[model samples]
Target: MAITDIPEYAHLTDADIEALGQELDAIRRDVENDRGERDATYIRNSIRFQRGLELSGRALLFGSGNRKIWALGAGVLGVSKIVENMELGHNIMHGQWDWMNDPEVHSTGWEWDNTGPSAHWKHTHNYIHHKYTNVLGMDDDVGYGLIRVTRDQRWKPFYLGNIAYNTLLMLFFQYGVAVQHLELGRVAAGRHPNPDAFKQDLRDVGMKIGRQVGKDYVVYPALVGAVTRSRKTWLRAITATLAANTIRNIWTNAVIFCGHFPDGAEKFTRQDLEDESQAHWYLRQMLGSANFDSGKTLAFMSGNLSYQIEHHLFPDLPSNRYAEIAVRVRALCDKYDLPYTTGPFLLQYAKAWRTIAKLSLPNKYLKGTVDDAPETASELRFKTDPDQRLTATVDPATGRRTGLRTAIGKLRRRRSPVPAIAGQRQAKDVRAA
Candidate 1:
């Protein structure tokens, strides 16, 4: 459903929206001023950890005659690759650490160890994806222009095979990301304005793929073969690299898919973007994001994008600060009666796959969908861990949330814009109507 069509929030005027935006901006300013040695130390120390893992993995790969050792090496190497892509590379390329003023760590000077060109990724991801965010049709990352994610998509018979196609895409996910700047869908649909420009972009992407393939499959493996002198050394080396890459690719696909496609995340129409105020934009960001209520391992693996809403609200803020920022964001949401979409890592991970499988069928057109979600009983209520990271649903009468809600009620009893009597009467009136 269209964003502006939501009558619930119509009570908030443009001035009220702007006031809410100022509160959010205050958080950004406070964080920006406070960033110092600790933030820099985190990034630098993380890079060392990643490099150490890669070196150890390659050293073990040289001795992969033992199947167990090879598996261990591949797992280690996969973690290295994951962190580089997830934490160090992706965040640096977002200009997150640029405030440190170290050229080596600067966005302009840093290049990632991936087939996807850093420049192109910044364009497609940092600029486009973050800017348009979850606005339907505008963001290319919406199913990467392939799988129909929402009911708004015009369906066809070909979508019947999307389950298979999405699986294949995950296996070769890096390759898909590498060529994303090419916008092949537009070219195929004859929407591209200049074929020559697109061809040049494709050629650049081709060179990137060649360099990546050679480094992983040929050069590294050959170095191992020379040291080991086993006839099967080159083969084992190549297999190990492939294994690591596959692990990294699968993880990247999973974490990203969970961020937006998981159960309660919402999407917006073009009209929503056009008429949006700063508060409206923030609201969209909150609705459009789904977070993982996971532990540290998945958090590091996702560059703390596990707090996807926080990332949307403050894209350039240090990721480590997301945990702290989440508390404030949630308080604000609760104050304004907004839904915070999140679940355990496993739950969101599975929900995203379920969304893909469900969308593979023709969208049943008999009923209206609201805010890009079906009118069925799939709405999620979030509950948080003690740290208040969204993980499950709060029963209205129990546990940590009950304590928090009691506090919230005490606070709101004084400041609530609407009277308690009117609120209940309104609810009853709607039911009677």
Candidate 2:
């Protein structure tokens, strides 16, 4: 059961949530007002760097007859693709630079180098995923309709291959993105409401995939082979391109998984969204996303997605500003005593993988209760008096706000016997507001 009562789960009252939302709104306005030539220049420079690196890789692959040169070319190309996909493509399509009014970089005009059609991706990603976020049964990205990442998803025998499915998904992530819009499972089960529309979408996906494959595998290899007049060189060029795409795919998968499926990235239920307010939505975004530690180079390579919480909160903001935005967002978290879910890159990714591995098993075999697991939790986990809504308050001793994070700590420290007598002692320890 995902969290149905977000305010209770967050230990926030209606006033606190609204005030938090106003602060977030102010942050958005500040960023929007601050967008200027500097931001535009940043995006332009990024485009040039990515395109230049890609061109250099292609030139190197022309002489890929040498194995070492082939590897270097592949590595460079892979990095370029990562920048294009993560930083440029993802951001641009999110309408981050729409204010620049540069048609070339506009969300409507720019088509990414991936196999997925930009139009289809915009709908699935920018709209559905961002709006629904971690709401169970709404966000297909929960497990990408494959591996079980949360206990809310029923464990079936098919999930036994969670690790295997994830490996394949990582290696060929672009293909997964390409087919995601089709909802093939529904079509296969004869549940699609409109077969004609599905067919059209499938055809669009096929064309995009075909173009990508031809450019990466056939056209480049043939051109290199014709120039070098060596069969080995042609084959090497194809392999190099394949290696590059694999690198991009694996890195993309890791960064995305780290931001999402890790511990502290909470899940919610549709009931939470019923008449949800702007402030509550902001709270949900904060609770349902995670971040990973990174410096400039690593952050740039990840498209600054290491600050995934900031990105989700202000998806349309310039990606270059996430670091600064994080500073303020963290301060707000501190002010409210909320959990700011973040960790070292490897640790975060490991947590995500760990969740996937553990969730493949039935709930009976798992250690944590459904209500209080690392990957799943509900308002019931707090064990507050149902008659009284607990609100965060300033600690008289420390003058610090004690809220969700503090409550979670208390819950974790409680012994097994504590719950048996929790009701008897609830009034003394758990204050009701």
As a whole number from 0 to 100, the lDDT of residue 370 in candidate 1 is 38
- 97-128, model 2: which lDDT tens digit per residue? 99999998899999999999999999999999
Question: What clash pairs does model 2 have?
Answer: none
lDDT of each: 0.77, 0.93
Candidate 1 C-alpha lDDT tens digits along 1-433 = 4344221222234554566588899989999999999999999999999999999999898988778988998999988999999998888888889999999789998778789888889999999998888677788987788887776667788777778888888888888889889998788899999999888888888888899999898899999889889758668888989999999989888889889888657666676776667777776677678899967777888999999999988988988889999999888766544567788888898888877777776667433343324311111111112333222234556432222233224334545657977888999999999
What's the TM for model 1?
A: 0.84
**Ten residues in sequence with the least summed lDDT for candidate 1:** 375-384
Pairs in clash, predicted candidate 1: 383-392
TM-score for each of the candidates: 0.84, 0.94
Q: For candidate 1, what is the lDDT? A: 0.77
lDDT score, residue 186, model 1? 84
